[model samples]
Target: YKAFEPQEARRILDKLEIHYTPKHGSWLNMAEIELSILSRQCLDRRIPNQEVLKNEVAAWQDKRNSISKPMEWQFTNQDARVKLKKLYPTIQQ
Candidate 1:
């Protein structure tokens, strides 16, 4: 394996910059969620060829676009408390 010389490494490092994202802020999560939905809704079946897969995905995309279902997050903290009450253990103080 070839290793970069010290001067070459310094030169490369000088041209690079690094940035950090804010905590708990990532659009990647939304992308993953959409892909998971796509897998469940459209990719659950086997496709004989690439052409059929492309057509199926395109049709699914068109149908999804036509619906234009707006995402609504009406589930509040209170709703979570009630729905997940069983998941939380009761501790007597």
Candidate 2:
């Protein structure tokens, strides 16, 4: 797949005929990123026993999920295109 533009990326995906529902809509990208961070922070340490690990993880999960809030998204494709205009190619076709 090639992407000369964002539309080209969509076109190549359509050509492949891969049907997918974007989980969490556009938040899928950020959710994946946050999961990576959570995995590293919460699960990266080695515990001596499963019970201890579970208890510790439960505490961490409760603390995190209780206060966690969804991110505030502001930019759209058009907004990004305007602010980051220099990063994109001028030609679409």
Candidate 3:
């Protein structure tokens, strides 16, 4: 189960004895990420009612899924070594 509010979420977590970390930081939460993506792809500069929002989001999701691929995460230590040598700590060469 999940909750949107911190107090309710804490209550549920305590009852379930489960521990989870929110992405980003303590104050920077997942809702911000979701809202940013939704705004850019579906809601930016437009106030579609609930039904239209749902339908448009669904259509956009369908189209995106048809061509979507997994993201490539390539910012490994080696990339950082070359790109940010000054900031990165020395590694075995």
Candidate 4:
């Protein structure tokens, strides 16, 4: 492979500063997201009875499991800092 250019070097440096989130660290968030999707896909509809709801949920779950879809996480550290600025303490200059 060819050597990295100046801009590539800068990008690498920026990546080095990014906060690495542990895979297990975001399991709760992942579960919530999956539940939200499940709600939108099937639970949001009006079910006739408990039996129908159970079948619908089971069918939807089987359909989901049939395909292997990986989670695509696009949130960056900069996004977290911007969206959750209130949670982080500010430094007095």
The models' CA-based lDDT, in order, is 0.78, 0.76, 0.67, 0.83
Candidate 3 residue-wise lDDT, 1-93, digit = tens: 344588887777678854566443443444465457767987776755889878888887787678765334456768878999999777687
lDDT measured at residue 27 in model 2 versus the true structure, 0 to 100: 57
Q: Lowest-lDDT window of 10 residues in candidate 2?
A: 18-27
lDDT of candidate 3?
Answer: 0.67
How many backbone collisions does model 4 have? 0
- TM-score comparison, 2 vs 3, better candidate: 2
**Candidate 3 at residue 31, lDDT?**
44
Off by over 4 Å in 4: 1-25, 86-93
* lDDT of prediction 1: 0.78
* TM-score: model 4 vs. ground truth: 0.59
> In candidate 4, which residue pairs get closer than 3 Å at backbone N, Cα or C atoms, i.e. clash?
none
Better of 3 and 4 by lDDT: 4
Candidate 4's error at 64, in angstroms? 0.7
Query: Residue 65 of model 3: what lDDT?
Result: 72
Q: Whose lDDT is greatest here?
A: 4
Strongest candidate by TM-score: 4
**Candidate 1, 32-65: lDDT as tens digits:** 7668988999999888999999999999889878
